[model samples]
Target: MIKVPIIKLRQNMIKKLTTFALILLVVSVTALPALGEDDENNFIALDHGYTVDYYKSYGAPAIQASITGDPEFERGETADLKIKIANVGVISGFKRLNANQKRINDSIEETIALKEMGEEEEATTAKDIEATLQSETKYIEVESTGNFQNVEELETGHTAPLSYTIKVDGNIPAGNYELLLPVTYQYQANVRTVTADAINLGITDVDYSREYKTKTEVLKIPLSIKSEPKFEVTNVSGSLIQGESKVVNITYKNTRETMAKDAFARIIVMSPLSTEKSTVRLGDIGPGEEKTASFEIKAAQDATVKKYGINSEIKYLDDDKNTKFSESMKVNLPLEATEEKFSVTGIAILLIIVIALYQIVNVHRKRNHNNENVSGDENEY
Candidate 1:
């Protein structure tokens, strides 16, 4: 070989040293336990298993995965991925070591029942019971690995599982892809010491396990949606003067599984008679629930004699947009069935005054004409 250049050898040595130093720094940071001071009660870490048994709930251990391709996605095309997670966890365990270095293990069992508790509160208490079962892993800790969007704290047995879908860019290539995910966990631990039955002055120490790291699996699942809405008019009857105010009642039912927001009820009168038309907004109605809107309608004094057709529409917003559910009813307001009374004496008094004033004006007019004729005759003579 040709003689080696000292300058080239020196440059290569420097490059190797710089790369080695960077790798060493990375290893030191990752191998170190999770951030936050570790004490008798707290233990934090990354890339390792947590002391908390994550399998207590069917929905816990949230794992999400996604894949994207180059050149963007096309319309009506899809790239799918499968998502999976380890659903198994150690529910509870206990162990003892004798003086002879003999080891013993047992499962702790306890029952707690609070009678007459509300359903939601009962479920929450069940989770707390599960946490208590993991008494050995009672130390608290925190760590970050960048996979999750934010820091998540998981108490023993108190976490619920989560799942989500990632739509692949339609134009992506049909191949396998991978991404580096960073995740963090903050947790606390509580350990049991001596029991009341223990006679010796010896003490026992409990330890919570370290945090864990695993890959996330993502899958493609399409969305499904449906809706139904119903309308009714209850307590539709009203009592008021022919020209006064009356109350109309309408009930709107969101028969659909989705919430109906910004809902409104429009009551239109089919009868032409001086109609009381009212439109009322009932706001939001939860799924499977009914809400009522009441409005006052004033009839005209000369309202029609026949029964009137009262129609209403319950308008609401669905995923597709605005929709209307309709209902109609015929209300009997028989004007002839009820009579209005006025004072006959008041009418007679008003007629008598009019006749007296007419007679006085006629007599005055005759006297004026006779005086005018006499004046003319005297002038001719």
Candidate 2:
């Protein structure tokens, strides 16, 4: 037989004792009583069943849900909306414990008893412990008011998408709008009972009874409706030359159903462009009616020979005499360079030069004829 040193033996014994103490501590902590009423109300428990019904007492469901749909919504347009709901109330590690608390307690008790009987090495495996617990919530149901309908039986960590068809008002302002999503659901409230099985082990039973409550939550779904200014630039006629001033005729049309009273066209001048007449009075322009406005505009000599955008807006006085401006729009103006055109002074100078050249040529021809005659007469003599 091998001789064992007293120091080595004592060290081995101490290690075993320490390990046993740790196991006992884990079991004691795991078997602690369910949360009390005050603690449950104050703390948002993520795992393990609680004896106090916090959600039901506060008229809130334990299930957490969210809404998702098209972020861009246009006025007077109908669209489909989706609301995604999930039971996110269950705690992570305690999911299984909450579901099969009694079964887990039984397993823990058996393991502790085995350890006390010198069979600690044969305790339950991690897989066996997990198998004894369940993480799914029971009897889950949800319903939506105002814009949606009912949804039922949602499991933990599982999401359900609810669809709805909604339309935005035509006259609604162009901005972010919020819609109310009143949700109602029935879920298992926290009602637990603990029963002692032995000195260090107990079984916890969580009631599967459900309670109903409605939660009105505001879903901040973004809706963007663009303003329809119902105005357009119809006809543009004019020629623009670098370093020259010209009159431009622009036709404005009121495309809206309502009439544009005391309408005027306003132009914004930028680089390479200047306008003496910026605003033109168009009087009243009815629906589908067009009116022309003449503006005196000048282009810089070094302006680019390309199309330039002219920013312009239409200001009108409504029936209440309130001045409202239509959405600013851009009109393209083309600039081109061309050869100098013929003028009266240029034509007169050309005619004078032609007459002078003709007279000189005629006089030279006469002199040549006379010289020829003189030569003939001398030869004859």
Candidate 3:
């Protein structure tokens, strides 16, 4: 069993999560509007803008991420996990940097300075967000590419979803798992008035000079691997010789908590390998119980002499008597190269045939020689 990282939720974070409603209300009413306009008029287009330093804000963007739907999942499941990110940070408070309300009251400069402070209030708005999702355990894997996601902007109390494809190990135990999402983004750190340059740039109100700072925060997403009956091929018996049929014994053990009722082992064989009986009945497989099923599989004569991985699964009745199939498992069977062999009687018969043919040829040669010798003697006389 792979260990799940023990997470210690910060006391402060729990309180912030519970204040979603308040955050939503404040974001709806007081969320800072975008500082610039659509055209080129709002941009100063200069090396720098003038500063006012009327006020300074204290809070920063606070990011929170969570799985959007039910986090519970079954083993051997592949799914697209959607994560929701929200900025729940508020402007905590603001300090008067150089405000002299008695003297600057109702002045044109004062109005412009306050307008600039509105831009400064955007410290809680996160921008140019990049979130990278990661997994620590081998039991769960992030399969999809681009695990690093980008978001142009996410304001306070506004949520955004990130999609990542993941695969769960069939043998992973039932428990809570944590996925880490480290998010980096820039937020408005300081803002100042740039009204002095607005006139020179021919813009109505170049408005504010904005300064940004980058921050990174990691958010933990919790996922539950559901408890269920899991099976694996523990042992394989019998060798497969080419051009011959053999009964292969495969033992399957339920490694999980749930009991598999009326389970039947089913195997799938492709070319070069064939099975007359693909399925064998295994009455019941309880927790940690091993069940062996014998399948008669034949290897073709031309089959390669290598380890063949045959796919197999389990079909069984669930708690409601509904049929369910387990994830595909591999049955590694070695196919031995065919070799020729002869019995003692067959070898003896072959040797006798060879000897009899040799003796007959020898006798024919001897008779021919004697006839030749008789002809020679008549000629001599």
Candidate 4:
């Protein structure tokens, strides 16, 4: 309203514009740092989202073994045995999970944890981890205190044969024995990501590798040792005719480490065969000694022509002077048909028929002579 100089007015307007410009510059400078910080945080969150943490959790390998042959041994004897080794690891498909799989795995882990904490109502069951991870064995080693052969690089569900020879001590009491087999192997521990790439703000490509570790454990295997009265039947000599009684001689060997005193071999005759003398006395048998026993056995008339098994055992006086019975053993005897006897019976039957026919012809001739004489007399009258 008051008249002012034009130059002063121009100065005032410039000053006001300069002050507004300064205020704008200050505001811009302060706000720019916060925006930059927010942008950096967003980038960091995206990078973290692309990484998977569930790949680090995994279990060890489980190895098992079994005997491939007979697991029985006698005292003071050497046994040759074979063993089969197998890897039964529960995990499978290792190092094959993607980012989405990782997320699913993380969710599964959370569910498992909740269930473990007794929150069953709130927990969800996840897919089995054993089906998700592909497990493998890098190498395997085996050892035993007695005798064993080691194997290497055994695969999952595959078996490797190991041979061993062991000697049983003479004084070892007869019982079940446990043999410990120490097994060692390496297995994949965890997979690590070295680098990763992004595509359209998503995790797409990654370079990773696996780490391995070693584990050692012992497994027990069972075996049996025979007692002091062990007996085995060998060198059986006899043939049984289908309809007749025959004498059989069986050779028995004492495979024990001690002597059996006042010993007798007893047999139980099975079907299709019968025996009156079921036992034979063998005075005394020492370790690794053989003795023979004879028995009279009769086979049934309708018995099949084949080998038959006789169950037999040994009764003897032990070192304590007490009577004991050994385990049952099988004795094999063969029965055969007597075709030559049948041929002889057939010939005898044919001879008897010829004699009867000769007698009948002689009688018929005599009767014809008598009838002719009577007819001539009647004509004379």
Candidate 5:
């Protein structure tokens, strides 16, 4: 055999090692996940005298929320909103730690560990869910105490609705609003195996304990506030006098984005105040438009001299021509005291009494003159 150079032989050996190393690096990068990324855990349950982290799951609970029914609501309404919470979580992959398998030697023990860890699908399950709904704008309010409600569990491919009461401001504009629903839930992160008997941990028929991970996700719920005609008593003119009928002019303003057709303004009057015609017709009112309605109201003679509150409302035809009534509005009207001055009738009576007194005084003066003349004539005779 021919002798080969030592450096050349070492060079061939080095090339083979470099090629082998390249192949190994490629396989490792493509095969298993990188360490400390999604691999194994260091948590060992010494209380149960067992090594945990039998399997590492590669998925978490993916939750999404949406409004159940009509997402659009009217203004000035306290409505119950049902939000449907669903879990769309799915397990991407799972890896069973081989070190635990070696530690558990018996076939029955390994089977038990496999069965316990096989429930990797539970990683997608959301449990002990606590949901809270919040509104960023002042126009909307989440009225439910403690931020609505909570859910026990939401399994994959299933949904559950949580009801919350929300109040919409009457003055809120007609538009879409973004409501935030923050949800906190616990999900199975990993299934840790208990090599010792499960009875020691107050659990029976189970050889594994669940490791839960808490996650917080803020979900957006889109809701729309419907546009509708809203009426308000903007201005009220004309004062009411005791024991007399007065014409009151009330100005109504449409403060919303919709129009009202064939609107009728009505006022409800209680005791000490009355009106023969309570309702007056207004032809049509548009957005930001104002309409004045006249009403004849009478106050009792014994009515107090103070400001009175008159409750009024507007009944109008909607876009569908359906009759609808607006929210009750209030306007303060002052009941003035009767003027402290004489009227035409009082002056006439005074004139008549003065004329009769003047006539009597003239008659008395004539009689006195005639008596003096008669006495003088007798003295002369």
Candidate 6:
């Protein structure tokens, strides 16, 4: 080994120092969490063998609404609306109790606010206490009710009921609609605090707070418009010829959830032999209703009188839109004459000919007998 000069040794020592400084800086940056401030377990309490801690807290009571009515409402009628409200707070009480305490007997009161959870935010035990002490208000809006309903001063484990009526206009079209109700609650909570000391004195912290808000639950309701035009046809039978005209009667019954608007019947005939389609339009039908449509069809010149298929499809409007329901059947067109007619006629003619022949033979035998008697009489003379 060769010994190094004093200058070279000094340069090597400088390089080693630089590398050591860089490694230390990298460790300090990467190990920041290890130097983080200590967590305060002020809210963590313990009992004989139980632990109680307020880890997460909410500032809003659960709101519920119940509606009751005819369960089946139609247009031009008033529907009753009843709603029940309640505050859900049993969880809040359980979280606030100490593990040492077996149960809580005192009433629990809290102020709630809706706040946004910011990015990289940590909840501290002190923030939970501040939230319970603040005042919060929530506003609720229901589209079905067309108004704002308020639940003022709702107590824990309590329910309130409200009722109202809504009238459906006679002219309203029938269909289903979804009622949307959105609720929003607003409040504030303490987020942080820092204290400053007087000159030459200890420091005191000033608490910092943040406003919080939350959206309420959405209420869904299915609302329907009602109408009263019903018509139905059943047991329809007849050949749907292409060009030749034929009449068929279809029995109908109105079995619709809602009434049919502008009730009418339209019959459409389709087939290869049918030249023009047939539709007999009849006017309005009522609910729980029954009606019949008589349709005439003509078979095309090329139409062969074979077993033609028949089907009836009914169309009506519910909630201002046309809806259709259909049924199908088979009918025999008068393609060929049945054998019954020819057989009956032939049998009758054959019977008539046999009777005439028997009469003629009997008359001829009588004449021969007369001749024999005359000849015998002449011989006696």
- The regions of model 6 sitting more than 4 angstroms off are 1-188, 196-218, 225-232, 240-243, 257-262, 271-277, 301-381
C-alpha lDDT of all candidate models, in order: 0.42, 0.57, 0.82, 0.64, 0.83, 0.45
Compared with the true structure, what per-residue lDDT tens digits does model 4 show for residues 113-169? 333223111111111111011112111112234343455455455566666666677
Residue 278, candidate 6: how far off, in angstroms? 3.0
Q: Write the per-residue lDDT of candidate 5 for residues 44-131, one digit (tens) a residue.
A: 2234354456567788889999999899998889998888988999888877675454545678666765676677778898988999
Give one digit per residue, the lDDT tens place, for model 6 in 1-381.
998899999999999999987876674444232222432212111121222222234434455544455444565566555655555543231123221222433332111111112200322111111100010111112224534555434544566655545565544555655444444443232232211211112111211222243444565544555444433344565655344566766667765545555544555446543424355554455566666666666666566657665555556555657564333333334432222335777989998999999999999999999999999999997
TM-score, per-candidate, Cα-based = 0.29, 0.46, 0.60, 0.36, 0.70, 0.34
TM-score of model 5 vs. true structure: 0.70
Q: Could you tell me how far off, in angstroms, the CA of residue 29 lies in candidate 5 after the best superposition?
A: 42
lDDT ranking from best to worst? 5, 3, 4, 2, 6, 1
Query: In model 2, how large is the Cα lDDT of residue 296?
Result: 88
Question: What is the TM-score (0 to 1) of candidate 2?
Answer: 0.46
Candidate 2 lDDT by residue in tens digits, 146-252: 33355645545556666666665655555554444444443433332222333343323322222222333333333355433356899888978888988888888
Instruction: Give, for candidate 5, the lowest lDDT window spanning 10 residues.
Output: 37-46
Evaluated with lDDT, which candidate comes out highest?
A: 5
**TM-score of model 4 vs. true structure:** 0.36
User: For candidate 5, what's the RMSD?
Assistant: 14.0
lDDT of 2 at 31: 47
Best by TM-score: 5
Q: Of the pair 1 and 6, which is ahead by TM-score?
A: 6
